[model samples]
Every structure is written in structure tokens, then in C-alpha cells.
Target chain A: MRPFEYASPNSKEQVAALLGTSWEQGAILAGGTDLLALMKDDVVTPRRLVNVKGIDTLRGTSYQPGNGLRIGALTTIAELADSKDLAQYPMLFEAVTEAASPQIRNLATIGGNMCQRPRCWYFRSGMGLMPMTKDGKSLVVAGDNRYAAILGTQTGAYFVSPSTIAPALIAYGAKVRIYSAKASGSGVRELPLGRFFITPKSAKEREHDLKPDEMVIELIVPPPPQNLKTGYFEVRQKAAFDWPLAMAAVALQMDGNTVKSARVVMGHVAPVPWVSDEAAATLVGKTITPDTAMAAANAAVTKAKPLSMNKYKITLAKAAVKRAVLKAGGAA
Target chain B: MADDRPRKPEDNSGVTRRDFMKVSAVGVAVPVVLGSVMDAAAEEVPIQGPGKVPITLQVNGKKLSAQLEPRVTLLDALRDNFDLTGAKRVCDRGACGACTVLMDGKPVYACAILAIDAQGRMITTIEALAEGDSLSPVMQAFVAHDAQQCGFCTPGFIVTTTNFLQKQPAPTAEEIRHGLSGNFCRCGTYDGIRAVALAHAGGKQS
Candidate 1:
């Protein structure tokens, strides 16, 4: 790695000032599990590394009586996975546990995982940042796109955001706290997890809505409903140390036997966590039987347009949703 | 490929003369002079590096402090700088658990963690498990059951098993398999490893 200056800031203000001054050439160093790998490969050549690990304010899991859980950005995956407050929010715990191997989870931070780069082979392996043609055409169309996007492929980039926790958080209606340096009165802003992602054409922006100099401080998960059932399931090629091929996060509120409300989101299937209101609509006021689950699974993928090699992912995604729904409904 | 035939001893004189000259030049006093110089250099160097970043790292029951690079991994900082070599570096990636160490009382792959991020946390390597020449109960059980082969992956397995047993001391066979799934042994010593964990859990060995 090229030599760069390092700063261990003690306060969020210090970090914000450092990042604000050096937006283009500076990188916030969280766990360094993902950022260091990107730097070592020269994918990102930041001239300054601001270490945020020293900030005591950005650590630990907190729970209030009515407001639910608020996890600091620096909290490790292992801590979130084993938290007692997550017993009622089983889908969140399940997603964190199924993310990576034990070692990666120990070093991977919740904020870092949500803000990680795409795992697209073409974008990661080559010299150029984005895979392009000689005439500057996107190369992902004809490349090895087995795990690429299935819904947002009409736009140029087909890479899926490799975050297992984002879908679960979105399903639970979580909110993110962003802190910026330039602003004085309103330095912080909160956005729902569903509105956090902007597509390439929509915003002409990055995968996430975070500003270059803004830092994600905390994530707030609303309290789980009283009669709620939740489950997370992922399909992987191997048992350990690999990303999921496709996954689903299912949350259901049941009134005795009939479904009161439901939220279904699919991971590794789009540029962001793909939420299907159609699937949720199919489950409302209906009993969670195998037939209803199959119908909801089919409705979830109705708008899905699979690429040539990823047609099998449709089936894998369907099975994942079905299994997640069944598990959440206590039928499996 | 061209020089298949053996050369005569006269042709080998060049090599012998060089070897003889090398041996004579470094005879008896050379080692003594070099050792003193090395000792002086070692004395001049500080025990910890610069910046002396304040970090409270509790390994076993002792609190330790060291100045290190921000990019230093927990595995390298422990093994190379602190001389805690029990956690071996096999793959260096997070794929293998040979470098497993307990951080905040949970078994984690040390290679994947940055040293700076491990501040204000408790770290436990395999070196702190036993007291002096005596072995811990888990280590004794491992020896009694012959649970290691080649012994490269023993420290990681032992540390993981120790943490697992602390949590679920009387784990069933299925739980044993599930808990040990994070680690891999190339020599296929898993059967013996499981036997030792089971034996220790059953109070069969001290």
C-alpha cells in the first residue's frame, strides 16, 4: 500500500471536520475489514485514513422502553448477533449470523457492512473502477453475471449491493442517522431504510444515499409488533465464507390465523434491498398456508426480469421467500 | 540439461576454495563481535513504537499496552510484535481459523481484525490458557485423547473448544459439531478433537 497519514480522532466532530476537509482523498476507517481490502487492491486510493475506532460514542447496543433498539455504527456483527434485545427481532439476528463466516463477522461492522462496495467480479478484478467497453459501454451485460441484479438490470450497472443486514433492517422499518460537518443548525438527518437507496438513473448517484463527508452514526429499529413473526433465509453455494446467492427477509403480523400485515424484501437481487409490496398485498387477510406462501412468492417475482445465466436465481429466490415466510409463520 | 556428466575434483576446486575462505573468515571471534553489536542495537530500540496510542487490551488477566501501526492486524500484532506465536498464520485470510483468538470472550479469527479496533477489549490467545508447566483441563483432556496430529491447528482448536465449553459445558454431540464448524483441520484430526471436547465436558479428565 502507498504510505498515507493516519489520524485517530476521539470525537465525532473531529472525524467530521477531517472528512469534510478531505472528502475526495480521505476515507473513514471503521473495522477496516472491507475498506483495507479495497485499499490493498488499489480499488480506492485515499490519501488520508481517519480512524473512527477510538470514538467511544459510536460503540455498543442501546435499548429504550418504547423506542426500541438503537445500534451504534461501530458495533460489531458478533455483538448484534448475540444481543438479548434481538430475541424479538429474530430476522435481524438471523441475517447478521448468516452474513459471513465467524471471523469475518467478528471484524465486520454493521455500518461498514451496509456501506460496503459491490461484490461484482468485473468491477472488483480489473483496473478501471467500472467495467466498460472500448467505446465506454457497460460490460456487465455479456459478462459472468450469475449473481448480478434481476430487477434493476435495465440501467447500466447490474451489480447487487452485498449487504445482508440492509434487507432485514428495511423490512423492520429502521432509520439511519447521518452527521455532516458543514451544517451548523441541522447537521444530522434521519431517513427511513427504504428511502436510503437511489438507483443509477434516479439520482445519478452512488448505491447508498450517504454523502462523501457524512458519517453514519446510528441505526434505529422500531419496536417489533406484539404478534409479529420474523425470519431470514439465504441460499449460498457453499457452507462458509461466501456471499449469498439469494436471500429473503420476511416479517408478518398475524391476527390469530389470518395475516394482518406483512413485509417481504429480497437481498442480492437488485441495486438495493428489493421490497415487494405486491407480495405483501397477497398475504394480507389470508391464512399463511403453503398455497398462500407459494402465491405470495410468485407475486414477489412477477416484475423480476432475469438475465440469461441467472434464470435459475428466480427459482432460488422463490424458494428462499417461501422458506422464510413459512419459518416466520411458525409453520416450518 | 547439457551438463549430464560428472566433473572431475579439479573442476570443484573453485567451490572448495570459496567455502574454505568463507569458513576461515568467520572463525571463532566473529560470532562474539556480531552478538554484541546486535545486543547494543536491541537496547537502543524502544519496546513500543512511537505515538503510543492509549489502548487498554486485557489479555488473560493482564492489561497490556503497545504502540503499533494502524494497519497492523491483531494476529500480526500478537504473534510478531508481542511474541504470542500460538495462533499460527496459515491462510492469512479469514477462511482458516488457525489464527483464532478470543476477543471480548468470544472466539474470532484474529487475522481479520485490526489491532487498533481491538482497543478497550479483552483478548485471549492460547498462550494464556495454561499456568507455567501445568496444562489446563482442556489441554490435559486433549493430550489424554490424542486429539492432535502435526499440531499446527491445535492452538486454534483448543482455544475455540475452551470458549465453547465455557458457554455450553455439557454440549451434546450435535452441538459439538455445530460449535466446531468454524475451524478446519487439514490432517483430519476432527474425530479425536471431538472426542477430547466430549471427554472434557463429561468430567472424564482433569
Candidate 2:
């Protein structure tokens, strides 16, 4: 890592002031799991590191019947996995547990998880950042794109969403609180987590909607619907700690044996956590049988335009959808 | 690539490891601020540095002081300056747990932790695991079970096992395997490692 200034601010505002107007001048060191790796690889060379772990308010996870679940942005992934409050949210627990190794989870925070860059080898491998472009063209379009985006590959960007928990959080109707030095009045913005991320515009663009000076302060999960069923499933080449090739998060609002509403989101197949409204619509007003599950699964990948080498992801995504819905419906 | 290209450290689209537990299970309230519990009369003297900064850390029950650049990682400071070679640097990233150490009673990758950033926490490394010429029970169990091949990974496994057993004294064989997934053994010595953990689990099963 390059030599950089370090500051452990006591308050969120202090961190904001130190960060100034751009994180390119300074990077917030939350868990150091992602930031350090980015630094070590020479991908990001922020001259100052503002340690936000010392900020008091941005910590802990709590839930209320009326107010819903509020998880501090600094809450570690391990804590999310082990929280007794999350015992009923199997979709969430599965996403957390299936993320990184236990040791990495101990050092990773949900805020950092939200700030992930793309895992495209071309983007990460070369010393120069955003290596997917050369001579004003995308190298990924013609190169090895097996791990690239399948849904949002129309643009020059091809990196898939690397977050395992993002789809689950979106399925559960979670919202994120963004604290920025640039925001008005309270210096905060509370928005749905589903709209939190963006597909890469160019290879070098920030993947999320967060501004350069913004810091994710907390994640709020609203109270789930009555008679709710949720499940998360990931298809990984290696069961140990590998990133899922494709995955799905399914949550169904059931009216006894029939579905009243549904939320189905796919991961690793799109630029952002890919929500399929078509898939969700297929489950409404129908009993969660094998036929319904397969129909919903097929609908989930109906619009997935696979890259030259990524047709296999379409199949994996369908399986993930089917399995997640079945598991959520309690029919499997 | 253009020579005039702006130096952009593109994003790290996060990461994934290969250490999930098949059947295994499993912070206290850490006060968020370094000076939160301090005397109120003290001035709010903020310390910011991009250069060599002096820091005092309580490592293995001793207050050790060092002047290091903010970018220097805890793993490098321990192995380079302090000469604490017990924690080896394998995957300098957080992927491999070779440099695992107990930071505030939790096992974290030392290489990923910046030296300046880890100052206020209670950092424990592998060097403090035993008395003079006396191995800890966890270490003894490893030896008894012959749970090593190259021994390059032994110190990490020992430190990690100590941390794991403290939390789960009665882990099953599968739990033991899953718990030790962070530390990679290239020699395929997982069977023996599992045996050592089960032998020392104090006969509790679930």
C-alpha cells in the first residue's frame, strides 16, 4: 500500500470534513477488508485514510416491531450472519454466511460491501485501472466474458454485481441511509437499497449511486409482511468461499397456499442486483407448485442477454430462481 | 493504454474466499470512539498523519511502541520491526488467514489491518501463545495428532485454533473443520487438524 495519512475521527461530521468533497483525495477505512486490497493492488491510491470505525453512532444492529430493522453501516458481516434477530431471515443469513471466509467477515462491514468495485479481471488485473477499454472500444465484448454481466451488457461495462447480500437485502425491502458532507441540512439521504447501485457507465465509473463524498451510514430493513416467506440460493463452482456464478433471492407474500406478491432478484448476472418484475408477476395469485416455480424461474431469465461466453449463466440463474422460490414457499 | 491516462485505482468489486463451513455454526459492544471514554477535560487533539507516526499498542499484554508510516500493515510491523515472525505473510490480502491475529479478542487478518489503525485495539499474535519451552494445550494437541506437514502454516493454525477453541470448546469434527477453514493447508492436513480439534474439544457434542 502507498503511504497515506490516517485519521480516526470521533464523529461522522469530522469524517465528512476530512473527506472534503471527494473520496479520491481520501478513502474511508471501515473494515479495511476491501480498501486495503484496493490499495495493495494499486487500484486506488488515496493520499489520506479516514478511519470511520471509530465513529460511535454508526454501529450496531437493532430491530423494532414498528420502526423495523436498523443495521449500522459498520456492522460486520459476521455479526449479520450470527445475529439472533436475523434467525428468521434465512435469505439474509444465507447471503452473509456464503460471502467470504469467517476471518474476512470479521473484518468486513456492510458499508464496504456496498462500495465494491467490479471484479472484472481486465478491470483488476492490469496496473492501469479500467483495462476493459483500449482504442475507445470494450475489450470485454470480444474477450473472455464468461464472468461478465448477462443482463446489462448492452453498454461498455460488463462487470457483474459482486455482492451476495445485495439481492437478499433488496428482496426484503431494505433501505440505506447515506451520510455525505454534501447533503442538505441533516447531511443524509434515505433511499431504497434496490436503487442503491448502478451499472458501470464507463469502465472507471463508480458502480453505486453514492457520491464521491458520501458514506453509507446505516441499512434499514422494513417490517416484513405478515405470512412472509423468503429464501436465498447461490450456485457456486466451489462450495467453500467462491463467488456465486449466479444466484437468486426470493420473497413471497403468501395468502395461505397462494402468493399475494413476490420479489425475485438475481445476482452475478447483471450490473446491479437484477430484479425481475416478470418473475415476480408470474408467482402472484398462484399456488407455489413445481409448475409455478419452473414458470417463475423461466421468467426470471427471460430478458438475460448472455455474452459470447456466458450462455451458461442463463441456465444457472434459472436454477437459482427455481430453488429460491421453492425454498421460500416451503415446498422444498 | 494512453500515457496521459489519469491514475485511477478502479474499484475492488468486493471479494470471495474458499472457506465456507459445511455444517459449522457461528463483536461485543465495542465503544465506537478511541477517546470517547477518556476524561472530558482533555482537549480533542486530533492526530492525522501521512508520514511516520508514533503509536503505542498493547500486543500480547505488553505496551509496545513503534514509529511507522500509516500505510504500513500490522503484519509487516510485527514481522519487520518487532521481529515477531510467528505470523507469516502468505496471502498479503485478507484471502488467506496466515497472518491471523486476535484483535480485540477477535481473529482478523493482520496484513489487512494497517499498523496505525490498529493502535488502540488489543492485538494478540502467535508469539504469545505459550510459556518458555511449554506449548499451549492447542499446540500440544496439534503435535499429538501430527497435524502438520510443511509447518509453514503451523503458527497460523495454532493461533486460529486457540481463538476457535476458546469460542467453541465442544465443537464436533465437522464444526472443527469448518472453523479452521480460514487457514489454508496446502499439504491436505485437514484430517489431522480435525482430529486434533476433536481430541481437545473436551467431549461435548451436539
Candidate 3:
């Protein structure tokens, strides 16, 4: 890793001020699992690092009976997986445990996981975020793209979102609380986690809707409904230390034996967590069976535009969606 | 809420020789900026360097002090400065578990952790596992089962297994497989490793 000035601040205000307004000026260091690797490869060379791990407010997970679940940004994946309070939301546990490995889970924070740089080979090789040739042809479209996005590629961003827990979080209607010292009033703002991700059009932009100085402080997941059932599933190359080939998360609000409403989201198959409204629509007002689950799964990938080497992802994605939906509905 | 703070000027000049020289020349500017921003705080925050800074780490029940840059990894600090070569740096990246060590009794990759960040935490390396002139229980199990081939991945495996057994003394078959999945053995000594880990966990050897 490159040499950089390190500032350990105890408060969010100091952190915001210490951070640079751009990637080059400074970078936030929570769990260095991702940032250190990026720095070692010279992918991101920040002049200063604001280590926010010292901030006491940005760690822990709390859930109130009538209220919701509030997860501190610095909570590690292992903590999230082991929390007894999160057992009601089994999808969160599954997603966290299904991530990298024990050692990585111990160090990697949930916030860092959400904001991690893309694992696209082209991007890692120092090609810009929207990797392109000198002639402006997309390298991903023209070259090997086995792990690239199958959905939302029309914007020229082909790299798949590297988040494993995002689909499950979004399925549960999670919202991110962002903190900025410069902001007026409370200096905190909230946004739906699903809307936080964006497909950047250029190298100057970022994959998430975060300003350089602003940091995610907390994730607010609303209380699970009495009728709600959620499931998370991932199809990966191996059981551990592997990014998902394709994954899906499903949350079903059942009316007795019938599905009253549903949310289906797929990950690693798109630039963002691909929220499948079509699949959710297909499942509403119907009882979950093998056939209905399969139909909903088929509907989930109907609009996928796979690159040459990644057509197999469509099949894997369908299987994930079907399995996740069936698991949510207690049909499998 | 509106962000009224004026945005800092962007330095799109990229990482060039000129930029490096400029950064070195103004090396003191970052701390000044940070100190100014944190003037209102109850406690003053100190900014350490792009250069070496003094840091003390509690490793293996001893407080070891070393001067290290902010960018130096725990693995490098352990192996180079402190001479604790037990944690092997195989994949430098977090993929391989050869750099595994215990931070606050939880397994973590030393390569992925910054040495400065590891301050104030208890770090246990492979060297701390055994008593004087005697192999640790985990090490003995590895030997008894012939769990090592080239032995490059043994330190990490033993460290991980020692902690894993403490956490789940009677781990199921599935748990054993999942627990050690983080560490990779290129020599394909997985069966031996599994046998010993299972045997150590008090499960009947298959």
C-alpha cells in the first residue's frame, strides 16, 4: 500500500472535516479489507486516510420490539451473523455468513461491503470504471465478461455490483443513514438503500450515491411484519472466499397460504441489486408452488442482457430466484 | 439538509513524479487541516504520517513498540519489524488465509489489517499458542494426523483451528468443513487436516 497520512477521529464531524472531498484527496478506512487491497494495486491513491473505527457511535446492532433494526455502519459481518436479535431476519444472517470467509468477516464492515469497489477484472487492471478502449468501445462488451452485469448494461457500466448483502437488505426495505459534518441541521440524511447504488457513466463518478465527505453511519431496517418471510440464496464458484456467480433475495408478505406481496432482488447479475418488480408482480395473490416459484424466477430474468461469456448467469440467476422464493414461502 | 461547506479543489493531476514531490514538500499540510477541523472537539485528534510513526501493539501478551508507516500491514509489521514470522504472507490479498492471526481472539488476516489500526487490540500469533519447548494441542493434532505436506499453510491452519475449537469444541461435520474453508492447502492435505480438526473437536474420525 502507498504511504498516506492517517487520522483517527472519534466523532463524525471530525471525520467529515478530515476527509478529502474527492477520492484523491482522502479516503475513509473502516475495515481495510477492501481499501488496503485497492491501495496496494494503486487503484485508489488517496493522500490521507480518515480511520473512523475510533468513532464510538458507528458500531453495534440494536433492534427495538416495536421499532426497527438499526445496524451501525462499522458492524462486522461476523457480528451481524452472530447477533441473536437478527435471527428473525434470517436472510440477513444467511447473506452475511455467505460472504468471503471467517477472517474476512471478522474485519470487513457492513458499510465497507456496501461501498466496496467493483471486482471487475477490467476495473482492477487499471482500466477506468467504465472500462473502454482508445476508440471508446466498451472493453467489457468486446472482451471477456463472464462475471459482468447481465442487467442495466444500457448505461455502459458493465461491472456487476460486488455487494453480497445488498439484495437481502434491499428486499427488507433497508435505509442508509448518511452523516456529513458540513450539512446543516442534524448533519444526517437517510436514503433507501436500494436507491443508493448507481451505474456510473464515467471514471469521475462513483457506483454509490455518496459524496466524498459523507459517510454511511447506520442502516435502518424496518421491523419484520408478522406475515413476512424472507430468504437469501447465492450461487458461487465455491462455498467460501468467492464472489457470487448469481444470487437472489426474496421477501414475501403472505396472507395465510397466499402471497399478498413480494420483493425479489438479484445480486452480482447487475450493476445494482436488480430489484425484480416483475417477479414480485407475478407472485402476488398466488400461492407459492414449484411451478409458481419457477414462473416468478423466469420473470425475474426476463430483461437480462447477458454478454457473450455470461449467458449461463441467466440460468443461475433463475435458479437462485426460484430457490429463494420457495425458501421464503416455506415451500422448499 | 444543504451542504454549505465549500468543496476542496480537486487535484486531477494524477500520481506523477511532480505530484509525489509536491505531496512530500507539503507533507505537514494534511495534519494542519485535520487539526483545524478538529479544534472544536473535546479531545484533540493527532494525525500520523505518510512517514514512519511510533506505534505500540500488544502481541502475544507482550507490548511491542515499533516505528511504522500508516500503510504498513499487520503481517509486515509482525514479520519484519517484530520478527514474528509465524503468520505467513502468502496471498498478500485476503484471499488465502496464510496470514491469519487472532485479534481480540477472533481470526483475522494480518495482511488485510493496518498495523496502526491493530493498536489497542490483543493480537495472538502462531508463536503464542505453545508453551516453552512444547507443541500446542492444535500443532500436536496436525502432527498426529499428518495434516501438513509442504507446511507453508500450517501456521495459519493451526491458529485458525485453535480458535475454532475453542469457539465450537464439538463442531459438527458441516461446521468443521465450513470453519476451515477460509484456509487453503495447496498441497491437498485437506483430508489429514480434516481428520485432525475433527479428532481435536472430540468427534469420531471418519
Candidate 4:
């Protein structure tokens, strides 16, 4: 690891000022679970790091009955997983618990998990942040793409979204608060969390849509309909301390025994949290029986164009969808 | 936030080398800090390198300070600078969890945390766990169950188990597996380790 200047800033304004031009100049250090690994691997060499863990405002999870939940950016994954009140939003609980191992969750922040880089070997190894061929060919097109994105990569650069928290949060209608002086006076803006991801069109692009000078201050989940039932399911290569092969989160709004509306999001299979409109369409106005779940599962993977080695992911993704739907519908 | 106010140089118990050299003119033996200030008679303070910075850390129960580059990991500082090498660094990344230690009572990867960033928090390395000739309870359990083969991953697993079993004294089978999932042994001693954790936590006796 390279030497860098370290500062424990008290306010978000000071942190934003220290962040420098890009991720390489000065990086934000929340929990250091992911950032240290990147530095150890020589993937990113930031000359300075601003530690925000000491900021008092960036720690807590508060809830209001008619309003929503406000999750501070520095809230640890273990703290989030241990909150019993989050049982109402079971998708979040499931996703938070399924991430990494227990030791990692003790140090990994929810915001860092949402903004982490990909697990693509090409990205981690020094090929590039977004691996590509010199002649504009897709390296993952015919290579070992077992964990590559099956959706949202028709052109090039197939890499799975590494976030375990974003899909569930997006299904729960979450918004992220970005704080920065670069935007304007006392700059602050709330963007829907679903719009936070940026897929690679060319090799020079980074993953998230965040500006270099801005930092995610908090995440807000809006109040949900009382009849909504949510579930999150992930299929991993190993049972512990490994990234998932495919995962799905479902939030179904029920009217009696029938579905009024639905939000189904599939992750680890796309460049971003892939919202499955077809699966949602199949669930609305229909009973959530195993038959409907199967139909939705089939519809969810309609756009999955698997790479040469990742054809198995399609079946795994479909199974995750079916399981998520059944679990959300209270049948499983 | 009261912490936002900067501290004056006179109010501090510690100072940079340049400040220490100026103070050395009045009192010959100023105070015995973690490092030797006897060389201050040179009449000049050496300029620190770009990445090098002096940091004071209260490691274990003692305040042991060192001059280290900002990139030095807590694991490296413990093994190299402090000469406490109980925590092994197998996979330098967080995946293997070979360098787990108690940070503010929670097990974290020591290798993944920078030494400079760990100043204000309480850090407990594996060297602080034992007393005299006897091993800790978690260590005894590992030995009793014959849970170790390579022993490279023993410190991390034992530290994690000691912290975990103290919180969950009566762990079920699933809880034992889930609690220790962070540490992995390439030698495949999980079954023995799980049995030891359960027995030591009073599961067998209960």
C-alpha cells in the first residue's frame, strides 16, 4: 500500500473538501473493509483518505411510523442486521445478513456496501476497473464470465453489480442524500437510490454515478403500504464469505389474495439493480400461487443473455426469483 | 462538536520532533516517551518523508507510539513495530480473516485497517489474551478438541470465538457455525472447532 495523509474530519463539508479531484487523489474511508482490500491489491492508490467514522451525524437508524426510516451512512452492517425493528422490512434484514461473514459485517458500513466496486476478477486483478480489449472487443464476451452480468451488457463490459443492499433498498423505495459544496451553496441533493449506479459504456468509466467531491450522507426509505410483503433471496457459490452468484428481492402489494402491485429487482446479474418489469407485470392482478411464481420466474429471465461460461446463472437466477416470490407471498 | 476545536501545543503531552528538539534545550531528560529522544542533541530535527508520520496509539492497555507510514496496517504494526506477532497475515486481504482482532469489542480484520486510522479506538491483539504459562479458555478448547493443524489461523479463530462465546454463552449448532464463519482454516478443522466452541461455552455441560 502507498503512503497517504489521513484526516478524521468532523463535518461533511470538511470531508468533501479533502476528497480531492477523483477516487485516486483522496478517497472516503468509512469502514475500510473494502477500501483496504482495493489498496492492498493495488487496484486504487489514493494519496489521501478522509475518515468519516468519527462524524457524529453519520451514525444511527431512526424510524417514524407514517414517514419512513433514515439510515445514517456510517451505520455498520452488523448494527443494521441486529435491529429487530427492521423485521417489518424483511428484505433489508435478509440482504444485510446474507452479506460477507460476521466479522466483516461488524466493520462494513451499509453505505460502503451499496457503493462497493465489483468482484469481477478482471477488475480486481489490474486489467482495469472495467476490463476490455484494445480493439473494442468484449473480454467477457467469450471468456470465463461465470459471475458476469447477464443483463444490461448487450454492447460490452459485462460485470455483475456487487451490491447486496441496493436491490432490497431499491425495492423498498430508498433515496440517498448526497452532500457536497461542489453542487452549490451548502450543496445537498436527494437522488433516488435506484439511479445511483452507472454501468460502463466505455473502458474509462467508474461504477457509481457519484461525483468525486460528493459523499453519501444518508439513505431514506419511504413508508410502504401495509399490505406489502417483501422477501430477499441470494444464491452463493459457497455458504460463507463469498459473493453471490445470483440474488432477487420481491415486494408484493397484496389486495386480499390477489396482488395489487409488485416490485421485483434482480441483482448480481446486471450492471445495476435490474428492476424486472415483466415479473412485476405478471404478479399484479394475479394470485401468488406457485404457478404464478413459476410464471414470474420465467418472465424475469427473459432478457438474460448469458455469456459462454455463465449459462448456469440463468437457471440460478430463475430459482432465486421463484423463491423470492413465494417467500414474499407467504407460501414458502 | 467540541472535538472540532484544535488543541494548543502546550496542552499536549506529545509533540513533533521539531518541537521536542526545541524543548530539549531547557530540560535534558524531558520525559521518557515511547521512543528515544536522547538524540535531540544533534541540534536539528530530521524532515519526515512524504508518507511517514508520527502517531501515538494506545495499543492493548499501554500507550505505545511509533513513527510509521500512513499505509502501515495495524497487523504489520503489531507484528513488526511492537513485536507482537500472534495475529498471522495469511491472505493479506479480508477474505481469509487470518488477522482478526477485537476492535472496540468486535472482531475485525487487522490487516485491512490502517494503523493511523485506529488511533482513538481500543485495539486488542492476540498477544494480550494470555497470562503467564496457561493459554486462554478458547485456546484450551482448541487444544482439547485437537482443532488446529497448521495453526496459522488459530489466533484469529480463537480470538473471534472468545469474543463471540462470551456474548452467546449458550450457542446452538447453527449459531456456532454462523458466528465463526468469518475465519477459515485451509486444513479443514471446522468440525473440531465447532465442538470446542460449544463445549467451552457450556453447551455440553448445560
- In lDDT terms, which candidate is top? 3
Residue A174 accuracy (lDDT) in model 1: 94
User: Compared with the true structure, what per-residue lDDT tens digits does model 4 show for residues A239-280?
Assistant: 767778898999999999899999999999998889999999
lDDT, candidate 3, at B205: 81
| Candidate 1, CAPRI quality class derived from DockQ | incorrect
Model 2 stretches with alpha carbons more than 4 Å out: A126-130, B1-47, B202-206
Better by DockQ, candidate 2 or 1? 2
TM-score of chain B of 3: 0.79
- Which digits, one per residue and each the tens of the lDDT, describe model 1 over residues B27-125? 223466576533421221111111233444567668767766555678888887778899998876566689899988788888777676677788999
Consecutive 10-residue window with the lowest summed lDDT within model 4 chain A: A11-20
| Ordered list by TM-score, greatest first | 3, 4, 2, 1
Candidate DockQ scores, in order: 0.09, 0.28, 0.41, 0.25
- Structural similarity to truth (TM-score) of each candidate: 0.80, 0.89, 0.92, 0.89
Residue lDDT tens for model 3, A230-263: 8788998887778989999999999999999999
- TM (chain A) per model: 0.95, 0.96, 0.98, 0.97
Backbone clashes, each candidate: 0, 6, 0, 0
Per-residue lDDT of A270 in model 3: 85
lDDT of 1 by residue, A169-269 (tens): 98898999887644566678899977777556522357778876788888999998888888688898866556788889999998998899999999888
Candidate 3, clashing residue pairs? Answer: none
Q: For residues B52-140, could you state the per-residue lDDT of candidate 3 as single tens digits? A: 77889999999999878888899999999999999999989888899899999999999999999999999999999987779987899
Reference contacts recovered by each candidate, as fractions?
0.17, 0.57, 0.70, 0.50
Regarding DockQ, does 2 or 4 come out ahead? 2
